[model samples]
Target: MWLPQPVHALPERLAQLIWGWALAWWRIVYLGAVVLVLVLSPSSYSRVGRHLLARRMYLDTLPILLGFTALAALLSLIITRIVVVTALSYGLSRYALEMVIRVLVLELIPLTAAMFVAMRCAIPSGAQLAQLRRSGRLVVLERTGADPVRMELLPRVVAAGFASVTLAALSCVVALAMAYFSVFGLGTAGLVSFTRMFGHVFSPEVTLVFVLKTVFFSLAIAVIPMTAGMYDLGASERRSELGGLARMFAVLLLIELVSLVGNYY
Candidate 1:
């Protein structure tokens, strides 16, 4: 049976897609194992190591995160105003709060926070880690039983995750306030209605899902670049370090798409 060339290539394409997904899953599994080990090992939390590394990571990343948060606030305010105005025009004012909560807080803020950390913090840290590995410093540390993964990687991951959560929380708060002001102005006139609407929008289930999604986003931003960088540690060919970053963003987009489907559908 003769078939069109495109149709004949369909199965091969499907196979390639499936294979790519399988490799991604494998990488995810490997990352999960690394996280599990970090969690289960008490020494991964050595107070001095963790504290010093965490302080360095947070201090180094804070300025960037704050700058990103400011930009996010501007964009969020615009979006909130638009949503509020559009809803009022359509006689859907009652749904405005819920729409803002679900769209901005549940969806936009977390993803933005993750990408901000990934670009501004994680990629550079990964490149540094890769460079250290290439220079044989990591091997020396490992030989001395210094457990660089615990003393080094875990703290950065924890700090990056903390930064992501902090940024997301801050952005969400800013957006919520902006949404209220957009809808009801700065006066106390709408306080009661605003509180009621906020409570209704952030029901237990909605709150839980938002928290879970934020945690997943934070962890993804922290872990993906580190793992990707480590995976390519020994490659003979020196490609651009941004290759890991490109892969990290691809994974992030997939995560965001899944979150959207789960939230809306």
Candidate 2:
């Protein structure tokens, strides 16, 4: 039986979509491997390399750190107050601190920090890299015997990773403090109970999961956009940006889901 043309083309379209997706992921993995190798190679960090890394790190980290910290503090204050009030109203005051810590420090802060870095630094850096590649600047550097990956991409990747981790850590501290003040006021009356609850919430297994999740989030934020930008797939610049952002969000969501299962299930 002869099928309609549209029906016959359906499978082809699906296959093409699958292939494109696989190719994009493969590029990400390959680029990540190259970056890891460069990072581990001491020869990649000569005096000039160190200067590039330091300058890029400063550019990536300092502009956003204070603003992000302030925003995290405000968000922590609001969330802590709400959780404490709700828990108190429900006669679940004892669980309030635990919930706040798990929800904010262990989960939300890291994800928020990753997203913030992605928006503030990673995506823009990727876009700039794409522009440079498109304009043949990367090729020019390559022709000059320069390792563009070492001089250009590595700094951005390392800086984004550091910024994400630093932001998450600082935000988590702010959140913990805000939660304590929200529940305990301006006194040390609840200090003993708070310490006990904090310890209970951050058991070894939970702490391990938290750390791993934050690291994965930072890695995704650091790597995905650059991969998309560096390896163009016959897409327009706008399309590339949108596609990279979507992929990055999907990976972040997957990491969050895995962490949630590890923690709760």
**Best-fitting candidate, measured by TM-score?**
2
Q: What lDDT tens digits, residue by residue, belong to model 1 across residues 177-253?
A: 87777777889899998888788878787777788878878777788777655655345324424545566677778
Instruction: For model 1, name the residue pairs that clash.
Output: none
Candidate 1 is scored at a TM of: 0.82
lDDT of each: 0.75, 0.90
- For candidate 1, the 10 contiguous residues with the lowest summed lDDT are 233-242
Candidate 1 segments exceeding 4 Å error: 1-28, 232-243
Tell me each candidate's TM-score. Answer: 0.82, 0.94
What does candidate 2's lDDT look like per residue over 1-265, in tens digits?
9956788799999998898778778888898899889989999789999999999989999999999999999998999889889999999988988999999999899999999999999999998888888888889999999988887899999999989999999989988888888888989999999999999999999999999999989889999999866865565557767877899999999999999999999
- What stretches of model 2 exceed 4 Å from their correct place? 1-5, 235-237
